[model samples]
Target: MECLASLRTRVHPVVVSAQIASALYDTGLQMVVKERCSDNSTATEEDRQKAISNFYMTYTMLSSLLPFVPAYFLTRYGDRGFRKVPIGIPLLGYLISRTLLLLVILLELPIEVMFGGAVVYGLCGGYSSYWAGVMALESASSQKERRSLCIMGIELAYGIAGFVGSLSSGHIFQIHAIGNKNGVVLVAFCIFLYFLCIIYTFFILVIPGTSAGNVEHRQEGNVGILWNIVEYPRSCNIVIVLLFISAILYDIAVAGGMEMLMSFIMKEPLNWGADQVGYSNAAGFVIFFTSFFGVWLFSKFVADAAMIMIGMVSFAAGIYFMSFVTATYLFYLARSLTLFALIPMPTIRSLLSKQVQPSSYGKILISLQLSFTLASLIYSPIYTKVYQSTLSWFPGFVFLLSSIITVLAIIPISMVGWRMARQEGYVSIEGD
Candidate 1:
């Protein structure tokens, strides 16, 4: 757990900064496109749009290659060399990529440079998959003293580091002037850096376990990977169902909240700037940091189901409250409370880990990402359309929808717990 905490301290801020940098980079690229097309009589609007679409399509195609990359390497290598080898690779790659992307953003590279970077960024996603495999080992380790300690450390680190990363991201964007209206150079630089992080992350996963061993858990038949995923065991199936529903709510609520708050409160009504964004994010981080203790406390005294229920109620209230806040300080309050409502994450993860084999960690993590992405991707267009038309309180409705869905999800969570307890012959409602 301590090691995880330390890693989170370092990694969280880095990832958050990367996110900010990436966003700024995209904005810059768009500005460059607009400027280039402005005076070009030979380029029709449709032509310009087509070019932009093609650029994005290329990037998406690159993304399609990422999930399989680490699996390919694992199948090929099987831990023949150094153990810590994979652990250190991604960190170096991240630094290298970040430096290059920073330079590109500062220098404003050509459109093709930015497009080419799409491939490198794609590679970063691939590199991170190596660590995803390690997480399986952590999950599968005996639930004795050492495993629990390790899990706690990891949870703490992820919370704190992620928060710091998020805070730093806003500040770095301001310092680099990457958020300017016209920021092509910044865009290219950011993407390059993102790719670099992917590479660096590749090295961070040094330890290997059963996946690195000679045992073959799954059958040697010709089943497709997708089929394996669909055939998860009963417990994993339940958790996955819950995770999918909860993650969709979580992502849409989070992304929509940030987008709306930043668009509205960060400027005129709030009269704030990048520094304020940093501070506000820092506050959110602190709240998340504090929640680590809440998890510990809950584990010590409260039932797991109780902790989850508390989280659900808190999260519902937090989401509902976010739709109504006005003052800048109050906005911070809302963010903090919402984050506090998320204290059950580690607990939930710990419980869910009991449901699957360690080798399935990559798939589980991918599923989590997929749920969030599915929500974000589907709602993005709808959210945009609503923002264009009903811009007032419409954004609140999005979160409210999440809250409603979350309430519905709690039912299944409770039901599953109830069924589990029944199977174990426990009769009380609080029984686990």
Candidate 2:
């Protein structure tokens, strides 16, 4: 009974709510684009694709680029007061953005006006700060030995919520009783979820010993922003550096691929409707659960590096298969092949955490998030442009490029495994 109580207290409701909101937003945005693009009967397919591509690029660019500075400040100073500030601020942003979407649908505002919501979301710290605060809260609440388990638990909750939310969003969007707009019901649901997240974060959630006066101060003593970068690498060995490189590459590839995939599926070959898009997204979310299972099953026999390599290969192969997908079944098959696709990033993070001192984990992770955000800024435009340019002849080119980039990530992982094996003075039996 006490164990259950402890578990209940530790479970972050905001995480689940945030995941649901994200899934709804993802599934709903595509529906919104379809509605907006279809409004003009004379618009060609090419024009629709261009408009979709441009809308996504604009939203992605703003959300990714604007969050950097705010996230830095929030993560650095958030510990001074309520630890949940960083986490809660993003939820507030999510609520406002989702509410804006709902209003847009109700008021029949211009679709491009959603960019304003993205801007508001970005200025409020975005996912980078939110996730960082989540990790910090988990770390603070759990014992050192159980920290990883707590993190995994949080991820599992997120995945489950996303899975359910994505599956339902399509049907929700089809509901006609709500204001007669296409996705009004779905957007309203998202707004409600974000509101709950904000309320829970501020009122119901409790961080263990995280009171403003009780928080520990950084020992680095007001060092310049560049100090972490200059100092931390001195401590990281080749394996750590290689791990960082591989993680960043994988992040960029996944981000670009996902952004392109959403737009790609809505176009020529598949032309998926809202329901089909929901199921496709549900398949993607299932990767998280499958990856958790994969890690548990593989950890009994293989090293962490081996597990990461296997995941990378799975992603590469699945993406390669996706490049050939002309039918929905083939797309599902490709998604199935990548069931373990979610493993590498978390595994790499765990390995990197082991390499650095406890005090430096925040610095390392923040730096990683910055790298990912920067990569996102570049990749969104590049992938959008590539997809638009190749829309007529080879729309699958983006997926193929994603596959190639994923395969390239394996090189650094291999180097890291070899270096680690050498350092341990063992015969480097790959995947052993």
Candidate 3:
């Protein structure tokens, strides 16, 4: 009973539930967009592809663009002890947005109405506040030595949930609740799951007080400081700024490639059906597992930055390989090369958490996430446009572009590692 209570209080359940709901919602939206764009009697394949891609880019814009202020404020409050506010409000947004998708399916409304749903989602804080809050909580709960593992474990839970949800998402999209209608049941279940997430987060979830490791660090006044090189009352922390730039660049590479990968696989030689889409999404989730294990095993030998670089190389090689994949098996083969791709971001977040005082870590994380949202706003449309223009000439060009950018993203991390080595009193994270 004590163990059961402890388990219930942990955040893993919330991560699992929310990710499951997200998988269903994403698959539902994609299929709906595909159906609608392809329904026009005179529309060619390229026209359907362009239309679908346009909707996604626009939806991503609205969902990401408006969250900057609201998310900042939400995490600001979260940092000050209104912890649940940041998390609960975004779940509320998710519930509302998901409900809109359901209504679109049930009422046969124009798919463009989802743009409003994205606006509501962004205004309510979107992923920036929610993930920042979650990371802050996780960071506080774990010891410094175990922080990376603890956070990676949360990601593992998220990935497992996504995998299970996506594995069944396609079949669920075809299931009808009352009448024989597509996506009604799937979106309904997504709403139901978010409802559970909200309830669990608010009523049952327990926010842990600071763990001993972070407390000890707080007590170490200026002794183990990583950013001591920066003068006091500084205009900006250069290391943090560099970290943000690195994270955003990596996010651009990942998001741009994956966003277009959806449209790419949906058309032409692959022409993936709903089941294949489910399988492909499930394949993507597999990286979380691999990355967690990579961190666990690699941490014993290599530094955090090295682990991040390893992950980046894995992705760079894989995405570049993706540029040549002409068959479904080849696509999966390319994906297989990215087994460690998810490692870099979480490791980067862990590094960020350690750099700040506990009281101010939430702000830093939210700043990073908001920057990622901003990057998505800029890159989504560009990747879409590039994919459309190259559709006839070479559809996989964007993947190659992402690979090059991923390689570029590595330089900043290498700088950080070199700086750490050059700094006195720093262990440089080469081992242990």
- Which one wins on lDDT? 3
Note the Cα lDDT for every prediction shown: 0.49, 0.79, 0.87
Writing each residue's lDDT as its tens digit, candidate 3 over 147-205 gives 98899999999999999999999999988885678999899989999999999988877
In model 1, which range of ten residues has the least summed lDDT? Answer: 75-84
Off by over 4 Å in 1: 1-104, 109-119, 123-134, 141-152, 166-205, 208-240, 259-262, 392-395, 426-432
Q: Judging by TM-score, tell me the better candidate of 2 and 3.
A: 3
CA RMSD, predictions in order: 7.8, 4.0, 4.1
TM-score of model 2 (CA atoms): 0.90
Name the runs in model 3 displaced over 4 angstroms. 210-236, 424-432
Cα lDDT tens digits for candidate 1, 1-432? 878645632433334444454444433334344444344688754454344434444444444354345433442232332222333343344344445444555565554564444445345443333344334345554463334335555555545655554555444554434456334344444656555555444434323332443333432223336446665557657755775565456556555444444434322345455456556655655655556566666667755656666677776777677666567767766666654465545445555565555444445654554445445445554544444344443534555655675577567567656656664574454474
Candidate 2, 1-432: lDDT as tens digits: 876555445646788888988899888888887788878999998999888888899898888888898887777665553567778898888788888787777887898888898889889988888887777666555565444445666777888999999999899888885656678778877888888888877776766654443344433345424446555434257777788789888887788888888888887679999999999988898888888888777877777788899998899889888888899889999999998888887777667666765445555666677778898888889999998999888888888998888888999999887777665664445546
Identify the candidate with maximal TM-score.
Answer: 3
- Candidate 2 to native Cα RMSD, angstroms: 4.0
Better of 1 and 3 by lDDT: 3
The TM-score, computed over Cα atoms with residue i paired to residue i, of candidate 3 is: 0.92
In angstroms, give how far residue 62 of model 1 lies from its true place: 9.5
